[model samples]
Target: MFDMIIKNAKLRNAKDLVNIAIKNGLVKAIERNIEGKAIKEIDAMGNLVTPPFCDPHLHLDAALSVGDPRYNMSGTLLEGIQIWGERKPNLTKEIIKKNAIEAIKWEVANGTLKIRTHADVCDPRLLCVEALLEVKEEMKDLVDIQIVAFPQDGIYAYKNGDKLLEEALKMGADVVGGIPHNELTREDGVKDIEYVFELANKYNRLIDVHCDETGDDQSRFVEVMAKLTIDNDMEGLVTASHTTAMHNYNNDYAFKLIGILKRAQMNIITNPFDNSVLQNRTDGYPRRRGHTRVDEMLNRGINVCIGHDSIMDPWYPLGKGSMLQGANLLMHYAHLSGYDQIYELYDMITNYSAKTLGISNEYGIEVGKPADMIILNAKDEMDAIRLMSECLYVLRKGKVVSQTKPSISEVIFNGKRENIDFIVER
Candidate 1:
């Protein structure tokens, strides 16, 4: 007997119903119908069934750590850093692990089972790194948590920062991370990028850098990052998150940079929800959106993914670990309201983000792939995005980890009965 079976489910790209059978934690078959019996079954009823969501960039160490000691009154990235510095000394392994676990539960319920989180390793205590490493192993069954040794503070700004970063890597951090824009000077920022690349190559780990997150047009570390990726031949293995500065670059310069990014084959992740509010604090009127050139990047054949960077964290005040929320914001800020653009927006969160995290091979809804998928309470892609659709069932390794029933509504007017589906009718 098969482990589980899902019947009459509608794929996002097709109009026909399909049956999916899972056995031994893998998709055994996908066809029009299956005759074999299974221990568990779910009737999707023509709802949208898709691959599990993926979050490409996040800060689990700082998640749910907002308004600690004080709030960010200035609403600037610099102020957030200062607040984080104040709160870092109070961190303990127990508390960090507790918060990380809570955040993972939130994400899993929203159908995000694969995540790449940055853990602050700049603290001499390395408490967050130690805690997250343990959490990674503890939650490996439910979710795949890839931890990055993130230096929130500049690597070269603090004393002994470089050594601490390398130490965190030796202790089993999966990726090498840096915040070059936070360095003391532009030249120092370049040096820190080189240092991170050297360490990543030495340890044979992937590279994910927080490059040029600021609104300064002069902050051009993305070019340096691209060149390094090409020189090191680490194209698909390297990711650049929040290249917001590119938005401010002149069209000519931006076009030139895009060529470099394409040649390097680096992945780009844009955090629309956080960048929209955290950036452009200095501008009074006609303030910049502070978002990267998402449309331009996609048009150039560059792989771009959307990220929910913060959840009740120092940087962003609101988030529920929902990729749909991130995608919705991206649609608005990026002016992607066309019929085709809406569908692509969904891809940005699922398949595109999966590619960024380098987990697409094991992710999808095809036969012989891992049976990790989600059934949403919407008929198609447009309906799903419009409703920020509820996840009816979430399956991990062919086992149901969570499920939620769709909301019900009744309408009776003038002795007439009507089935109310705002998503379908509106």
Candidate 2:
């Protein structure tokens, strides 16, 4: 017998309705009409159904902790980092776990089933890493949380920072992370990349670093990371988050860098919302957008993903962990508004983000894949993005994990219009 069946779902690319049958946590079959009975059946009402969303970049340790130690009065990255440094000393496992769990629940409720979060490992206590590790195990049934052992402070700036990173991996971090641009010197920035690569190789873990997250054109750590990835043959396994310097690089330099990035096959993640606020602080007139070369990167065939990066955290004070909102803002700022480009923007938050997280095989809606998907109250992909559709139902492994009813309203404009009720089903 089938475990569950969803009837009359409008898939992302399909023009007609189809019924999906789930068995033993995997999609068993997809057809115009499913014949066999199941333990549970749901009528989708011809709503759009597709794979669950994936948020490839976030900070679990700092998530939902805005204004804890103190509000970011300056609203700058450096001030936020300083505030975080102050707050880290007071963090405990209970506090960290409580906030992290709350954030994960918010994400699941919003239809994000997969996430890659950076846990600050600069502190020797390792409270963030330990808390996130436990949270990952506890939330395994609802969400897949990949923790990166990140040194929010520079790896070389903090005492025994390298040792702390190793300890975090030993405690079960999924990826190696660093802040190369924050290092003391250019030499230290280069050395930080080497250290991250070595540790990733030694532990057989994935690499994701905060490379050149500033507007300074001299922040060239991204090149160092790309070269190391190519030399070490670690393509697809390495991700460089927030290469904001790419926006400031001269066209000639950027063109040269593109070749290196293509050769390495490394992924790029841009946080349009956060960077838009934090960057361009020093500019007066006609300021820059503080985003990466998304258009250029896409044209060059270098994998690029968009991320929320933060939600109500010190770095970014406003966000709801919604990938749709992220996609909307990114599409506008990145100037990707063409008919096909809009669809590609959707992929940045879904398929491409999954690839960045190394979860492509387990993230789609194909047969034999895990039954993780969301039902949107929209007729098609374009409508979904246009309306910012709400997830009426979210299923994880054939089981309903979260759901919400759409809002309905009745209004009378005038006697000529008459009184009519409008049901807003999401």
Clashing pairs in 2: none
TM-score of each model, paired residue for residue: 0.97, 0.96
Clashes per candidate (backbone, < 3 Å)? 0, 0
Against the correct fold, how does model 1 do in TM-score? 0.97
RMSD of each: 1.4, 2.2
Instruction: Report the lDDT tens digits of candidate 2 across residue range 240-355.
Output: 99999889999999999988998999999999779889986787788998899998999889889988888888889988888888888888888988888888888888999999
**What is the C-alpha lDDT profile of model 1 across 1-426, one tens digit per residue?**
999999999987786999999999999999898989999999999989999889989888888888996888888888988999999988888877888889898888888999999988888888888999999999999999899999988899988889999999999999999989989998999999999999999999999999999889999999999999999989888899999999999999999999999999889999987899998889888898888999999888899998888988788888999998888888998898998889999999999988888888888999999999999988888888888888999999999998987778889999998878785454
TM-score for candidate 2:
0.96
Q: Candidate 1: minimum summed lDDT over ten consecutive residues — where?
A: 417-426
Write down the lDDT of every candidate, Cα atoms only: 0.90, 0.89
Model 1 regions more than 4 Å off: 411-419
